[model samples]
Every structure is written in structure tokens, then in C-alpha cells.
Target: MAKVTLPAAADTSAATVKVWDPVVRLFHWTIVTGVVLNLWVFEHGKYAHRLTGYVVVAALATRLVWGIVGTRHARFSDFFPTPRRVITHVYALWRGEDARQLGHSALGALMMLALMAVLTGLGLTGWMMGLDAFWGVKWVEDLHGLLANSVMALAILHVAAAVIESVRHGENLPWAMITGRKRALGAHDADIAD
Candidate 1:
């Protein structure tokens, strides 16, 4: 393992660092609730369902804006999953290197971006389904269903990846999102400045 020092709040103690802000956590759980309610709990096209969808759309919009001007780790620039970054992450994993990241890993970042895009698709198609011209349009309805399914699938993968990475890095990642704290940076770990 290579020794590395990160630019962020790197510490040698066994303490946790704040990563996800409250806004980020709220957005995450709000989406989780909205997606669950819209997909499973509420009836399709009902007032509750549509209202939940709109809430989800609002949350997504808020997150998109927050990504531009949020806290250090909340900003997209911290982990945008560029092609080169993803490739390097994958290659390190292939070589059995420690690819643990202080913020989102490259693959995790890709998954987050993908899920957001699919959620946006769902929001757009859902809205179109309510419009005058697109009302009861088969294509819009189909696309909405497809996007919903994509989000569910991606969300499952995201959860599983978080669990696995948490185990690999000796920390509970899902809980970290809730508490907004993660273990301090260590050797062989990549922080935001990495």
C-alpha cells in the first residue's frame, strides 16, 4: 500500500469526518420515499402518485442546483466520474489495489449520475403524461414505466455497492449518509483532492 496524504480534513485519529451535508441527505431520503411511494404504494395516475412524482422532481431539481453550490463533498466536481477517473479506478481494483475513496468512488459516482438521469427521465415523462397533447399517450406512459424500473434497478445496485464498499473500507457507508460522517482518511485511501 502506498502512503498518501489528502488535502481535505485528513486526520490520523480514529474519528469521523463530515461528508454528506444535511441537504444532500434530505434529497437522498426524499427521493427514496418518493420513488417508493410512486412505484409501489400509490396507484398510478392517482393524485397521491402524481403529487409524489412532483415532489421527486422538485428534489431532483434542488439537488441539481445544490451540486453547483453546495458543500465541498456535495459538489459534483468532487466526484464527477470522468472517463479517465473511472478507468483508473477500475484498473486499480483489477490490480487488487485499495480503491477506497473518501467521497464517492468513480463507479459509485457513475451510478449516481445514471440514477439521476433516469429519475429526470421519469419526471419528464410523468409530466408529459399529464399534458393536454400527451395525455393518455402510450409512448409517454411506456417511457415513464421504463424510467421508473431503471431507477429501481439502479437503486438496488447502488445500495449493494454501498454495502460492499463499506465492508471493504471498514465503515458503514449507508449510515454515513444518514449521519454525514465517515472515517478519517487513511493510507491507500483517496480523498476529494485525490
Candidate 2:
């Protein structure tokens, strides 16, 4: 059997490090609120739903721009999930090893990308359904519904993963998103200097 070296576990008592920037935090919460409103609070196919969808689209657009030119950890390059990295992360998980990352971990980055893509599609399809040319079009409406469901499914998985990873790594992932900071890296943890 090949030997597998695991990354070191993080020290619980380590100093805190700033990871997420203000823009990243704001974008995350905005999307969460938009999703909640669209899924439950706002009436479907109504003015409020349409308005919330448009706001989500605007937030997604801003996030895309931020991913290109935002702070160190917000830039996509800081945590792009390559195939090899994803596989390595999965393997590490299977082996019960910690791979502490200062920015998004490989699987987290993949989930982030998926959520963003789904949101963009959802927004586009919703807008298309509203257009006069596509008004009352069954396919457009169906696509919109499908995208919405997909986002919900992905969101549930995202939350579960965050909870699992938080327990595994002894860090509050959701709270980190809120406060824009995480426990500082330890000697055994992977160094992700952004």
C-alpha cells in the first residue's frame, strides 16, 4: 500500500486570521436572503418574486466581478478546485485526515462554483420567462422551476457539508462567513497564503 501523508490538524487555540472580506460576506448573506425570500416568503410568478430574483441576479453579478478582482481569499485563483485537488481532498476525508485551508477548501470551492452557476441559470431562466416573447411558455417556466429546485438541493448539501466540516475541523464555518475570520493556521495545517 502507498503511504498517505495527512496535513496537520489545526490548533484550537491559534490566533484568528482574516479570510473573507466584507464584500464576500455581504454577497453570501444577500444570496441567502434572496434564496429564502424567493423560495418561501415571496409568491411565485408575482412581482415580489420577480424583484427578489432580479436582486439576486445583481448580487451574483457583483460576486462574479469580485471573484475576479476582490481580496486575496475572494479571488477565484486563491482556491480554485482543480480535479487533482478535489480528489486529494476527498481522499484525505476518506482517510480521516485534516486539510485545514485558510481560504475555501477544495470541496467547498467546488460547491461555491456550483451554487453560483445554478443561481445564474436560475436568474436567467426567470428573466426569460418574464419576457413577452417567452410569456406563458411552458418550457421557460419549467426550466425556471428546475433551476430553483436545483439551487435548493445544492443549498441543503452546502449547509450539511458546512456543518460536517465544522465539527470535523473544530471551526464554525458559517460563523466564519459572517465574521470574515477563522482560527490561524497551525504548523500541521496547510498554508494557504492569499
Candidate 3:
């Protein structure tokens, strides 16, 4: 894992630091748009729907590569939530600890990975539905529907968690993703080095 650098704690200016790079921001918004379009805007099996799926898959593929070689916070290693970390974070949350992470929180990291996996599964099943070998295959269609529903449910939970964390940590996480920066590390936050 790369070193995670944190800002000085004495700084009370509420400054922001760069975290998500342009590639990461683009990938995030692209997925969000694609999900919203496919879920509520575009009709299923329509040209727009398939095109959006392909676009989202392409973004996912790019993200997979970026996760290995992207900027500090964007790299998966920066916040890959191990089981121990997840448990620690959960315990802290249960105890109402601040536990504000400068980058992705452990639970946030897990949610990200889960969303990606569900999206990949959805894309695969959607692609399969278009193949001749799977024509009239109820299972393929059913699986696709299930994955879509899962994505929606997960998305809702993701937003709710973001809101909860924002309240607890005094930072707008969704805005951070858009702005590609976050409030600098505070004294209470666990310090790290780059």
C-alpha cells in the first residue's frame, strides 16, 4: 500500500485537499448517470439502455485499471477494507466514535466494491440476454432483473450512508466526489502519511 499523507491537525481553516482525481470523478459520475438512466430513464432493451450499459462497463474497466495505478486516494490500496478494518470501523460506529476518514471509510470502501461487483454482474447478465444462445432463457432475464434491483437498493443505502457520515464527520462526501477534494484531516482523525 502507498503511504497515506495527512495534513497538520492544528490547521483550523477548514481547508480542502485533493483526493479523487479527474479520472476517478469522471468514472464516478459516469456510473451514476448510467445507473439512473438505465433504471428510470431509458426503457429496457432499447438502444439507449444498451448503449448506456456499454458505456458503464467501459467506465468500470477503466476504473479497474485506475484502481491499480491511479492517484493516491483513488487507488484501491488507499482504502481497501480488510475484515479487521471493517470490524474496527463498525465497532467504532456502534460506539458513536467520530471515525472520520480522510479518504474512504472502511464501510464506504466495502460499499464501493460491492456496488462495482453488482454492476459487473448486471452488465454480464444484460449482455447474455442479447446473445442468441440465451434467447427465451428466463433465467438470464430473471438474473438481470435481480441485479438491477440489487443495484437500486444498494444505491439507496449508499446515499443514506453518505448522508450519515457527512453528518457525523462534518463533510459533504458527495460534494467531495464532485470537487475532487475533501476537508483536511483534523486532530480527531487517524493520521496517515503518503
The numbered model that scores best in lDDT is: 2
Error of 1 at 19 (Å): 0.7
| Clashing residue pair totals per candidate (backbone < 3 A) | 0, 1, 5
lDDT of 1 by residue, 1-194 (tens): 99998688735647778999999999999988887787665555678888898898899999999999999888999999888888888888788785566788888889988989999998899889889999999999999888888998999998898888878778899898899988888776777423
Residue 132 accuracy (lDDT) in model 2? 96
Error of 3 at 44 (Å): 7.0
The CA lDDT of each predicted structure is 0.85, 0.88, 0.86
TM-score of 2: 0.89
- Model 3 alpha-carbon drift over 4 Å, by segment: 1-13, 191-194
Candidate 2 residues lying further than 4 Å off, grouped into runs, are 1-12, 192-194
Q: Each prediction's Cα RMSD?
A: 7.0, 8.6, 8.1
Q: Candidate 2: count the clashes.
A: 1
Model 3, residue 182: C-alpha shift (Å): 0.6
Give one digit per residue, the lDDT tens place, for model 2 in 45-122: 588898898898999899999999999999999889988888888888789775788898888899999999999999
lDDT order of candidates, best first? 2, 3, 1
In terms of lDDT, the poorest run of 10 residues in model 1 is: 185-194
- Greater lDDT among 1 and 3 belongs to 3
